[model samples]
Target: MSLNKAVMLLKIIFILTAATSIQGKVYHPSYIDEASTFASSSEYDYIVIGGGTAGCPLAATLSQKYKVLLLERGGSPYGNPNVTQMQNFHISLMDTSPDSPSQPFVSTDGVINARARVLGGGTCINAGFYSRASPSFVKSVGWQEDFVNDSYRWIERQIVHCPNLAPWQAAVRDGLLMAGVSPFNGYTYDHVYGTKVGGTIFDKSGYRSTAADLLSAANHTNLRVLLRATVLKIRFDQSGSRPKAVGVLFKDENGNHHLASLNVGEGKSQVIISAGAIGSPQLLMLSGIGPKSHLKAKKVPVVLHNKFVGKGMADNPLNSIFIPTKKQVKQSLIQIVGITKYGSYIEASSGFSQSSKSISYHHGIMSAEAGQLATIPPKERSFEAISSYIEKKVKKKIPIEAFRGGFILSKIAGPNSKGHLKLIDTNIDNNPEVTFNYFSDPFDLHRCVKGIETIAKMVHTSHLLNLTNDDDYSMKMLLNISVDANINFIPKHFNDTSSLEQFCKDTVITIWHYHGGCQVGKVVDSDYKLLGVDGAMVVDGSTFLKSPGTNPQATVLMMGRYVGVKILRERLGSEAGV
Candidate 1:
């Protein structure tokens, strides 16, 4: 470890020691392995499902004053090199194991999306670029701005850190400005439009402190975390007039069944589902709390007929430009972002060229369009939409010894299209059917096309001229996209918007920012309480009304903190509107 990380670790230890009575041990232990260390049959003040990005902090905060049980479907990240190392960020996604941190799946729409199955969730595997939620997002969701800001503070101090920008990332910063994304705002985590160096989860030593680290401030005496514990369903007690969530039934790593129940009371006991947008909605439907007709079709008993359980699904789609350099450049993930006004954001990452074997074909969350025509109607499909399909696809890995250059990614910051998640079968082992009608809205397609043109312009900027041009900016490197586009073609000019649409159709994929399958104001209230259910709540990205204008990690963290406090406040009769 570097001196910077050593000091930070030591400082954390110091705080834990100094405040031991106030806070308990925050360590990742396999509750299933050590049965004596955990309870077999017990009651918790709260049962928190899915120890992920949202679940970790939410359970940690709740454990301060109440007994909380947090269950994770995958193993711990404590000893996983692929999860704790910054450069190995992509390695976990390449994992095909059933319990991989990122569980890969193909959507009904033929989009390749992965759901987080491990502790700390996507923060354990995603590009570490971090930023605050847009102020508009906080307002639209009716979140207390002060509480949200404070919640971010609790996370930033633990896992969030400033990145040491390398030469390639610096070039990306300058290039974005040269492309007219002006007024560099220096290094800050505030959400704003224009060029800015945001926060990162990777420390200066390249070690990542995941959201699990936030548990250090949790009351371990009141908290219990079970890894390899798959929650099959939310057990409901409909003995009263309204159905109440009483507990959850989960299986341990040994395939032994266990039931975790809430303390006996009317509204005294609670269940909070933080299993993410996909898992949360799927679990709801399986528990018979979704649409009546859909649940009945799947042979699930009707509990409450919530018509909008799995209706709106939004994913931020991106188009990438891979420019291979002759010389080796510095390596890093996301460091700088160019937030523009054209309903798009241009962010760049370095450091991938060093890891040659990891960039697999699965990187394309949405494959080429020809294979996708099956998802749509035959009348809606056309021959022109099939360019660069399976035939023109690039190789899984680049063979060049020193393949180093820039990777400029253009993402539609705000998308108009929405999809849904439905049950394929009644078995909990079976995955839910996900359909992302990505470009279903022509306006969304138009926005992504505009983003593509913006990225092309950024590539040709004077700041990045050194990439394609030699000294004196005359001769240039080969614009050979034979592998990427499958044709020997050079850009006629930087502002070429004609092939822009084709490029997006061919290479665009999801950035893996999925939200709104169980949206707020539609399915749940602003406070995140299930509309027709009592004693159950959701505090994950599934509650997002729309995708925020930036990466959703910080926003998700804020929601966890906000809802955690809200639950605690209501329990105490303070009723603070956080």
Candidate 2:
């Protein structure tokens, strides 16, 4: 048979196989139900809100022995091509519809960002890089080291996959080594200081397996997952000396309200908010657990005055160099990462195709200016403003071909610069205003400068230089060494410290590794229990003081399982009168 016919036959077989597999995997989880079908009220041993990265695994682990109800504001990711297909990464973010899994929001700091609005949370929409928390990070968080390791292994076994490095990725890996980032760690899920190929949630077939897939480990009979259930407020019993979270008031997709309550007689029954960094803190504030003055200003009845609910928000600042090569690079997402001692991470992705709509709306460095104008929905923009903005940006439109190349990006590790989240209103659907205050701290700024300098060194390295044609303008653009470099692009020289610093500030973008709104010790205890309330806790990225490892997803997934086991052990001991 001809090669073309053979390839076509393979594609057909793969699609058929994938269709059958998906039917068994996502469609019939059996425990999931739409919130529209939910009764007016129900009781459970545990009520977990937000079925994203952390929530799904937490709920699944809890359901192993206790009755658990998991509430997610978004729909299942089952048939979403933009989410499941690795090639359609940017397509998911381009969708600005109300029901889009990737929810776009601009920070007050003027950086564009996105938050997960789907069942699997950020995992459903992210680049899928997976790495465990550094040992030091684990120790600082006060988790038992052995338990943390075990939890990571549990998650790795379930959802993580070792990615085969594409040509561009392999070249980037060698480039990182040549740049003096040293001690090549080969392929590892462990967070080590060096260049390494990390695990990904996308498998060999380029299909994603999200935290929602972790539900396969759950006791389905004991778990009830409700989709399109936006929890409006935490229902607290104030009759006691201290407020206790008893239930939650939530609305379904159809706007009908329902209450899911914790079992009254079960003293250990609790409500866990795993609603991510932004959502968790916002939920807490809306539920009247934030700053007393802020809650009052929003007309929310205060249950407790924590003073700190939406503070310490931090997002690692990312600066990238887009390298358009003479030779077509294979399409890839994050596979190789350079973990440096200079408090920076170097990562790369190559060859992504974005729709024109996405390019217009993308908040990345390429069209960030246009993105600012596009932030407002089309209906909200005046026709004149829309036309004028489009004329300027779209008229000089970047050809889709320019995007066929890859990005070599750098993000500062555990950025010391922090900001806060504030309520614009009490509605959970509306995103709370957040400011990351990127590079406000001199330490963070210094780290960024060093990181960018490192990138310059990498591009000049033999590995990357060998890949670039000598006459190629893209290589010269790396450091703007050649007069032939693209004149439209602003190039930063390695030795020019001022230029690098300015470049860092001017082109700053979010890697979407933001964390710490409802921070540890401030809003919740080490055990993740809410400081001011009984039978309540926040168990998500919001509790993190820093982003763990190279990416937070793997650690977040591990956290769910870790915390669930902890809670289960405590409950079991309590039942046995220990």
Candidate 3:
């Protein structure tokens, strides 16, 4: 190894060792408290709306000099096994309980997808893949390169790890190279073209470290985090020249209401909304800051009518093929990826353990999407309604065992097929109606086809077939003719161009990489502040025009720290009269 590479390896080892040393201990920060403990009203220099991936790090960084308050709608992830363990990954998404960490929503396009509801957001339930956004992406967004690099390092030091590739992942990596993906870039965190082993949030022992761990760096005396505190509205002071967001109305877990306001200080206090893509736009509309016609129709008093508030929504279209091996494959999540020039990404996961009960529940949830109960007008769901929905939708019991198979997934890169999000109900807890309009652009459809072809070539490579315990003939037969409950085989002999295009349309699913809605240069200014409002900003995936990297978790985490540092610099400059 070169001098720089050796030093880098040593640094990673030190950090990982320090992280492993604390695996067995529970260390809840002193700033954390239940929402019920809050008074009727409180004030802070910075009020962060969502305590998810971006919110935690933003709040932690701001607390270094100013008082900060972070409000989360769900319970903590500290004690949740489904969120903390890698093996139970699918269970969290399949869970349909009232307080489940993953909240399922069906789009108008007839796709069933889930979003994060817990304090740590998607990081708590994701496949834990981690990679930084490309330098070109940072430059496009006009962020300082040095600051972005520092922020990425800040996040990596806490939760990121170089994964020890399992046998299946190793074979896939070799196959990617053999199939002309080109230039093997060994292990890396950089988002470069070609096959490479990327960082994972799951450690060697399969324990997931989330963005919430960033809160350990917070100044407890300056920060206060309230769990189960759902913000209902952003209260504006119309007396000002521009309607200024001065406070927010929120409800506690016990159904009691409370208000959190910005403090009257010289530091330019503000309310920052770090809610996910769906939640941020929904909250903004609920606060009367959407299109005039839509708000009036919903009986919501209009505050600021920006036609683009909920426009420009987009979700990367994902297509996958299931490979069911005859022998047991070591279970793993996404630890390796193949970045292609054809505008698609290839990744694989093996041996995901899914319980029979959860599989049944998953089936019922998707089935319910086609029924009237899924589109019920009520914002609050009752237990009886849920029970009725399940009973009616689940006609037969599914006999799914712990799955021993793996999947080869291809995700479209920066999909040009844009969508929109709109309110279905007024309640903050309710899911909004969204339509991704997958493959609406011909370019996106072509990319999907190219991606599928790449995966087909990789599957046929000798590297993959040779490493498998099953004989080559059987594996080829399985590839040629096998259909699972979830995925259908898109055979290597699928030569017709029209057939491949239709297959792309018929089997498209979400990789949970959806972003946009309150996009930059539209609803928000370059600084992420809402265009027509003051004292408020939206700083999450909702503001992105394109998804960053192979996985967005790392960039999203870096964004929180990046924005915090900028705000601090501005405040310091103001204090010095620069």
Quote model 2's TM-score: 0.89
Better of 1 and 3 by TM-score: 3
Q: Write the per-residue lDDT of candidate 3 for residues 1-578, one digit (tens) a residue.
A: 23234334433543453466447644456778889888755689999999988998999899988889999998788866778887667656656566888888867766667889888888998999999999999999989999899999999999999898998898789878988887889899998999999999999999999878888888889999998999999999888668888889999999999989899666388999999999999999999999999999998899998999888888988877655555556778899899998989999887644334434233222322222223232222333443444345322321222134566778898999999999988988889999888899999999988887887777768766664555464345444343322223454345666777777776676788899989999988888988888899999999999999998999999999999989988878655211
Model 1 residue 508 distance off true place after TM-score fit, in angstroms: 1.9
Supply candidate 1's per-residue lDDT for 482.
42
> Model 3 off-target regions past 4 Å?
1-28, 354-402, 467-487, 491-493, 573-578
> Could you tell which candidate, 1 or 2, scores higher by TM-score?
2
Q: Mark the regions of model 2 whose C-alpha exceeds 4 Å error after superposition.
A: 1-28, 353-391, 394-401, 476-490, 573-578
Q: In model 2, where is the ten-residue run with the lowest total lDDT?
A: 481-490
Give the alpha-carbon lDDT of every model.
0.71, 0.80, 0.78
Worst 10 contiguous positions by lDDT, candidate 3: 364-373
lDDT of 2 at 499: 79
What's the TM-score of every candidate structure?
0.85, 0.89, 0.87
Q: Over the stretch 9-121, how does candidate 2's per-residue lDDT look in tens digits?
A: 43454355356545554563678899998875568999999999999989988988899999999989987666888876765664556878878777876676789998999
Residue pairs clashing, model 3: none
- lDDT per residue (tens digit) for residues 276-297 in model 1: 8889999999988898999999
Tell me the lDDT of candidate 2.
Answer: 0.80
- Mark the regions of model 1 whose C-alpha exceeds 4 Å error after superposition: 1-40, 353-402, 471-479, 483-498, 573-578
